[model samples]
Target: MKKSISKVLLAAVTSAVMLSSCSKTPDESRYIPKTAGVVVDLNAKQLTTKLVTNGITMDKLFEATQSKDTSNEVMKAWKDAENSGIDMQSHFFASFVFQGQPAEHKSYISLTASLKDADKFEAYLKKNIANFSLKTQNDFKYIWEEKQHAVIGWNKSAVIYISAVDPSNLEKYNPGGSSSPDYGDPSEPMIDSATAVTDSAMAIPAALTTAEDDAQIKTWVAEVDHLFHLKKDETAGSIEPFAKLLKEDADAGIFVNPEAIYNSGQFTMIPANVKKLMEGSFYTGTVNFENGKIVFNGHSYMGKELAAIYKKYGKKEIDMDMLNKYPSQNITGFISYAFDFRMIGDIVKATGMDGMVNLMMGKSGLSMDDVLNAFEGQLTYVASDFAITKKESPYFPGEFTEKPDAKWIFSLKVGNKDAFNKIMTSPMLKEVFTREGDHYTVVNPMAAATMPAMSINEKFVTLGSDSALLQEYLGGKGHIKLPDGIEGKIKGSMLGGYVDLEKVTAVIPEDKMDEDEKPVAKKAKELLKDVTFVSKADGGDVQHGEAVLTFKNKDQNSLVQLINLGTEAAKVMQARKAKEKAYEDSLFAAPVDTTVVAPQ
Candidate 1:
């Protein structure tokens, strides 16, 4: 019985986070209070409608994966909310705010749901709260219950959860608690609940009853409310960058202020270079479900120094024509990036990495700049085929090896062939490489032959794990050509790629998994079997890009299928755990040997 309850509890916790499956329409950014330091908003309604139009509903999806004992409190709550005239499809925002200034900062995560039938929702919310009382009478842990503003409990340091109600409209829910104080230390020192003892069931410490502590709770509540209520003297608008992105038709978005993060002093452990890189840039990201695909794009506004470096040496125009050299069909996936490595070297210098590089190269009479000038920067990697090899073979495990081998072909455009050759032919390099007609082939010292090869030309240098792939490309036997449709999508971007999901899934080896896990792996393959991805990145005044994952299935969207896969995996995992638990319990509860042998 205990094991059964544990299994149910595990399933309940897993399903709770996945409960954001309801649908809702878009609402303005006004629902997010200006005080929010970071916010994530989801359009459950739009997603739900999209699923329903394609023949799948949230309820149906859940029912398909239902089991006898798994907890379904979240789904039940969703049904209740929907039936009570609540806008089933409304925008829900999760915001994180720093409660106080640096050194004494207390952070809180709050949620706001856009309300459609406010009166009906409020009545339903109040009734639900009436049946529940505070578990701890004196230990006040502030939790936002339903439409109620925020109930100030005894312990002010507890994590709070808030609902979607206007701050101005919350007067009715405010009990006659002490008015928010004007000024004083608002930090509530974290209480040690594990060790502290109390007479009450909640174990409220005696220190909490002091007048100073009680007043601190009032001050904390006032501070939380103040975050939503903008000050008259303030001029810098609340989350302007993020709000603008929301207004621009983004289904969801997130933002973080560098100044706020730096001042928080919570990130003192991060490296200086990384911190500079983050603090010197502002980022805003958006998600959109359009054109039968889900697209996520992030735009970065680089600080002055970084932008200048990028403009000087990093920027390049991408030419899709280069993709024509690749095999037109039978290709699983490919990635291409247009970059100038020399410019990258310059950026490294600006970032203060030059000193470290110089120290490493000091004895060798080489500098970072000299190293960066050696070869071309642009690169393309193509995965043409995959095969299973055996263990007894000379080149690979003949028929004895169990794992599959991945075959890849890479082409890197050399910036300077002369410099590249000098390094390849250097004394240190001569030990591993032997000159072959126009390039070098890495040789096995004992075998003297079996090795991967690299080719160099005036325009490009190519390497292949399998020499046959390199020979094929050089011989023009199996050049890959991008489909016209995919080509068009990548034309104007500095970097881009396309992956054939069907081709990738077709190669999944079910033999790799245990007999029981094979079925779940097979299900995953089918779920994402027909998806394709097109991605691109562009550099300019602001660097931004998005990868669009398009699904070929007409019956359901990619997200719905993804959720189904997760649900299926969860069910499989739960069953496995239950089986293990039962086995464990049986060992302990097994009938003991009642026959007492002669005492030895």
Candidate 2:
């Protein structure tokens, strides 16, 4: 009867152990420290779903990339990941943490993930790694790879991997001192191992030489411990904006702390005052892969002082009338911006650097105010009618070559005409350009021939590549009608840009391209459609921006299209290489003419 009781007790203990190992872990974001300089989060379930929906699998990817070796370590590891006992559907987080002082500074990288079965994970590691061992310390178990300067620690439900460099291996932080090592002359005799050791002993302090190898390992283990034991308030989830960004159901998200990054010891050259200004500033961004396009949305939050400056100046709207006046109706691309120039002067004065700027400008008979006041802070650059055509070479007359040509115009709204005239007629610029009626003309004949025509007036200053186009614009005889998709976005944005990829690809001159290049160009033209971006200030301290890269296929996911394009391009490259090799081999295999010839 006693023997039967012993057997039952053992079985109960085994069951408890199994149950503990299978418990679910907390959210991955909880392991990221609030002060982490940079954090990248990946929603594995969303990514996997998208891949599966697109008919993309690991085996397919390997085949596409032409990886036929199944016995390789990478392939073996990938196969093991299928049932490695780690939760594949949960989120994964990678974070960068900067800690310690300048003298003993250390940067730590940590990757946190959930576990499905701890015992199975351990077994998986043992099977993959040679001579692997697990060491238990306090409340968790860990593995230290001394050569890799990394440590992996795990609890019952989660795993954390931390890697850091030993501070002793880094050079001592000596202010205003040269730290370059003395390698001596390369021609000098090599030292024996005994001599080298003796010299090293003399050069390095005893304390450094005697430091334990496991000191960095201990620190990394401590970091792992801290991650697993973080309080609710200490995690990145506590940051309101970052938390909201993650909750937006994005495939991936990123959070950056500029204050923490600039204040780190690695950036010691940044002034303390500048670092202070960066305090409380952070940025959050999200990425989504959608049908026909990839979209990126981001928000930037400024600190109190910067926010005050921005609010004081307020936001400026782009001058649609000025942009509409662009002479080209077939524009391939354009970028427009609206911002108050005076805000730059205000910021310089606030930072106490205006005096130095004015002193430098005083030599040119101009003040910082004169330069900043010349523009009303609205500008547009447009490029249209891109073409590749054959033209006679200037250096070698009658020799024709293919060259790319485009019509481009750049214009800026005039703020104070008097300030503009003062800058234009300054001693520095007066020698190169001469005032001609209502505009300025290049004085040098060579420059006049190559440079674009410049026209200036009280309302606007414009430069154009074609003389007729410039005259048409100045006469108000031309008006631009933007595409419907781009017009809506550009009209509502303070900063806007558009690129017509179809127009660009149409002018590539595919008939003149090499056989290998033709396929890639054709694929690119089929895959790309257009690109557009919009950015605006949200009235307070927050700013928002978004960009979209659209593809030709409206029904397929952009990620899948990109993968297919990459695979096809790789195949073309492989074929090209094989063709070149065959030609080389043919030359070597040809029979040589062995007939003897008499000298003449």
Candidate 3:
């Protein structure tokens, strides 16, 4: 009975050990602070798999980039990293933290990654880097690179790198304070020299020296250590949306705190009212690499004020009728958007900047309301029939050169006829445009020669590169037929865009291209198919969007295609450089024309 009990206990212990070994480790993102203004997470394992599947090994990439020198520091570091015991299969995180008062603002850049063997990494660093030393404090070991103002710290599980600027040094350079510089005008109050000097003196700090740098490095080291010991609540993982984005199995993910970034000292020149607009807003996005296309999915959460405004106006779908009226069937590209113009007025008023905006426009006898109310908020810009034609050079008579030409139409739906008339008749525009029936024309000869034909009415205001095309559009003589896929995306979207890269490339004069540019252009044409983007309000305060870049080969991954293109481009560039070098060498080797004619 005792022998049987011992065998069962040993078996249970073996099973527990196996279970522990098989469990997955946590990502490095848990170490990033919630206050980080921006965070970027890279799925190293996913990226590596994609590259490998695409036949893009690091050795091949280095070869393509002409990094043949093994002695290169970057190469050496990369080789060392391979053996450093860092977990290359886990997610890596980079974060930017913006904190502190405007007068003494601090910015911290942090990079975090999981570790397999901390001691091996330390040894690798010491072997590859000069003047490297490690210090121990509590639970973590750290090293500071004084010149870079960066501190690298690590424990048994993960490594963190923190770098920051000394705010004192920033204060020394920006002695005029965070406020905008006073550009004195007769209408505005002038700041006397004595007052200016006092303000500048107060804003400026003592000069920065080696001692201050040392202190800053020490602070960074503590910051690194603190990051390693952060509580779960203090981490970015606590942000619900950001955490969800990380779990979406994307190739990469990004999170941005607009309020924190805009409030940073770097943007001190921005008006307080403008900065308030970004408060409480955050943005998150995910990037995925799939077969045939690369996609970016994004979401924006607006502030309370902005959300209220958005909710009030709601979303306006793009007008298919207006887009269909475009005069050409061979359309190359287009950008269509539907939004309520009144939202701009509301936002300006909400930010309490309407008074200043009206004050600036008062000189022209126009108000912000007059400008915002004139548009119905649906706009479409279409370019078609792109071609490269030989035209007589304006500067050199009788000389012809290739010039790109395309027919384009820019149309905007009219909201209120009276408001539109008010803007057209405003003091600033009255002298520039002349009314002919329901349409307007440029009064200046130079402007008329360059500007497209414009027609305005209660329904729409349209500008066309060709007058006939403009008349046809107004008369409803043409119809635009978009691809079913593109039409479906744009039909109900608040914002949508499409570009036919293949068509654009077909119009280029390949004969005119330089020797070095031809191969790259050819490769690009072979790889690129088309690009499309669409965005819409998800609901309430959130906006969701996607942009896709599709490639020609549907079987291969888009990333692989891109890598192949890059490698081909690199080869072309190297050949060009070699040829140029040969020419240069031949020039040097050739004997000088010493037996030249006495007179030219």
Q: Which candidate is the best by TM-score?
A: 3
TM-score pick, better of 2 and 3: 3
Question: Alpha-carbon error at 153 in model 3, in Å?
Answer: 0.5
Q: Which stretches of candidate 3 lie over 4 Å from their true place?
A: 1-26, 67-77, 101-105, 165-210, 265-277, 441-449, 513-517, 582-600
Model 1, CA-based lDDT: 0.52
User: Tens-digit lDDT track for model 1 on 269-329?
Assistant: 5557655654545667877655346677777666666677677775574544445565446
- Which structure among the candidates has the greatest lDDT? 3
What does candidate 2's lDDT look like per residue over 9-51, in tens digits?
1222221121100112237778888878888766666666676
- If ranked by lDDT, best first, what sequence of candidates would result? 3, 2, 1
- Estimate every model's Cα lDDT from 0 to 1: 0.52, 0.70, 0.71
Q: Which stretches of candidate 2 lie over 4 Å from their true place?
A: 1-26, 70-75, 101-105, 165-212, 511-517, 573-600
> Deviation in angstroms for 435 in model 1?
6.2
Give each model a TM-score.
0.69, 0.82, 0.83
Candidate 3: residue 516 Cα off by (Å): 5.4
